[model samples]
Target chain A: MSDANEAANEPIAVIRTPISLDYHYSAGQSASRFLRAIAQGKLLGQKCPVDGRVYFPSRGACPQHGVTFGDEVVELSDKGTVVTFSIVRVPSENIPLELPYITINVLLDGADTILIHVLDAKLEDVRMGMRVQAVWKPKEEWTTSTANILYFRPIDEPDASYDSYKEHI
Target chain B: MSPTLEKALTAPHKLEYTYKRSLGPVLSPFFTALRDRRILGVKRRDGRVMVPPKEYDPDTSESLDELVEVSDEGVVTSWSWVATPRRQQPLDRPFAYALVKLDGADTAFLHVVDAGDEGNMETGMRVKARWADETTGMITDFVFVPA
Candidate 1:
């Protein structure tokens, strides 16, 4: 063995290994209901009795109200305003989607929480407060997964005013 | 538990972590042998052997590099029966996770013992390495079975 100085430059054998772990997750109360609604081509939101704010992909409990609304589920509209968006151009092996895709965080009608999904439109056409609607997959392809909606696309309506979605941003 | 909540929809989900890691100098040799169906142990200053060898002595700070070959057959020092195996475990059925002392080794290594059921697992029971159909130099390359 050499001294610390010599050891610093010593050749070492390095072994590279790839590790993969798999798990089965239980989608608890709220998530289970939300997924079921997606499977049926509908959007469900849960309201907080204390704040009167509804959350899409219902959080089983309300953080602001500090209460649980097990029986206070509400249906939400598919259309939403894009609170924000980013244009992704860098290609990566890990990402499943195509390059140059637009990712947007949407605040659905009647819901307080934002839903993140890809925007099916050109980067030049997307802007803050842009109204987009969920384009669902064919009925045969419907399942209890967020994949039920292919992507959100621009609707025939005008862009929402910045003040309308400022709180969400 | 709330009684008013309706029955929610359920679906199967698979979770995975995609990554790679490098095993340093000491343990690298141990796993490399596993790829070739062999076992290596590290020798301590007192001459006792440690299987699944570590880079440093647990009792002393001395670096250990003496590699010693040990027989795969070993005795189970302790064990606990798992009735229901979790996902991604070595075996999909029942098995005992045991501390095994291999021949020529002083320390025990934690590994699974495939004894079919808890009734067949006992302290001092002799077991041997049952290699996987395909080896990849990982700790999961083999499990122990009754010798």
Candidate 2:
């Protein structure tokens, strides 16, 4: 650091300005198909030809297979078993939800991959292998966005067997 | 397949930032011209004038000393059409983004032309600077328009 006397001796003009650049991003092929299915209150998954593993919110290509899944998408059930979760108690300005919300990774029925979403259940009530279903918003408000399904909530059924989702965890 | 998903869709995104730049002795006068609604260029030892004047010559790396006034009017050397203007662009409507060689200056300056349509824009077309109502010591203080 320079001394105050040395700083005063140097001659320079400091120009401070603000800049904002706006962009329009295009969601690629696989995500586009997944988002379209979400608008219709449906869930879609894609399977890798090589490993034969199913990925929700289709990635279009499998890194393992090194091949693109062109028009080879599969339908997935909305019901799922929670593999893991974290209770968010810390309040942040960017989080639109209220405090003490539980965010969980659910392994949907017949899906090899897990989907991360907010689960509307009491923090103490949320447990691993808890069965949950998607709660869709009104059809009129549907758009090509995942927001169509508001959030996941527990069904009135018994907890799922750990063996069913242990591999996913 | 849903018709909406048959093709690509665009989503809005914004990046915001503030930048601060320190100007040294050689380039200070160039930006000061923008404040006074004037334009200045630096002359190299070989007598070539560079607009938006640089401190040193590009070829010889010699320190530039002489600053000369260049006419705001210039000829458009090359240009491309912006059918859909992006946010914060100089103009809200269609315009031409061009590299203009200002009069008495050897180098070209990058700016936009407010020509009504692409058909109206052509090579060697004359353009003059359109100053803003209020002056600020920034390159965006003025833009080029058909003269």
Candidate 3:
């Protein structure tokens, strides 16, 4: 072998094989049940009597209260504000949104935590506190999946100001 | 129970991961040196130059300070062999996974080798990197060739 002065160059890599777990483990069917509700154009939120708001894809437990919730399903207003957002450039498995799609944390009316969903409005026009409504696919096209409701976008009318929803963020 | 169920072969289920780690600061220099066909180690608090350069002292947890260059040659300090592999392993064929301590480094590092058969591998045998042609910054980028 040669010294640092004469050694032939070689390369090495630190690869990241990032992974995410899906319902295949313990809750795929449960998640599907929640997804089915969204496809029907209704907003379903789970109530954790003591713990309060947990919306969609089934909130089996209230992380804050640490109590299990078993109650009647209820619907909330579909309208919400973009509490925060991120545009994912990298794609992963099971992601329905295309590149440059807006993934926003929407605080639906009456829910404590925000629900992550695709934003349907154009990237340039998107602003914080902009009021958006969930646009559901036609009744025939609905599926038991969140992708069933295309994405949230600005409602046809006026938008909300930053001050109105700043605290919610 | 049933004839159809009896016909179904049931073998062990397994999930294996052949992780390629980017050694970052400390191990990065060593791997790059390997690609450049050189060997290097980092000098640690105990004055020992550990190969596959460690970034922090295992005992004190302080950042490793200096980079030390070593000979590509080393002795096989320890080893494990795969008679068969599950998935993502470097080779589809049988091979030995060994810990080699290059000449100037005090610690050893892991890599694979096609040392033919189990009878041919020895704890003290010398070896060198059989570097890949289009090397990526990864350990699989090399297979050990007899030195």
Model 3 lDDT per residue over B1-147, tens place: 222221211223334343345556777677676556666778887788887777898878899959888876778888887889655577887789999888888878887867877777889999877777865444566788668
Cα lDDT of model 1 by residue, A1-169, tens digit: 1122133223323433335544456677788878878888889999888878887788678877678877667999999999999899887656788889999999998888899999999879999989999999999999989888889999979889988889888
Q: Candidate 1 lDDT, tens digit per residue, B8-94?
A: 665555444434445577776787777678899999999999998988999998999998999999999999999999875778999
Q: Where's the lowest-lDDT run of ten residues in candidate 3 chain A?
A: A1-10
lDDT of 2 at A160: 90
TM-score (all chains, Cα) for each model = 0.74, 0.52, 0.61
DockQ score of the complex predicted as candidate 1? 0.21
Judge the docking of candidate 1 as incorrect, acceptable, medium or high: incorrect
Candidate 1, residue A147: the lDDT equals 88
Residue A163: error of model 3 in Å?
Answer: 11
Give the top-scoring candidate (TM-score): 1
The lowest-lDDT stretch of 10 consecutive residues in candidate 1 chain A is A1-10
User: On residues A68-103, what C-alpha lDDT tens digit does candidate 2 reach at each position?
Assistant: 766778899999999999999898644699888999
DockQ, 0 to 1 scale, candidate 2? 0.30
Whole-model lDDT, model 1: 0.84
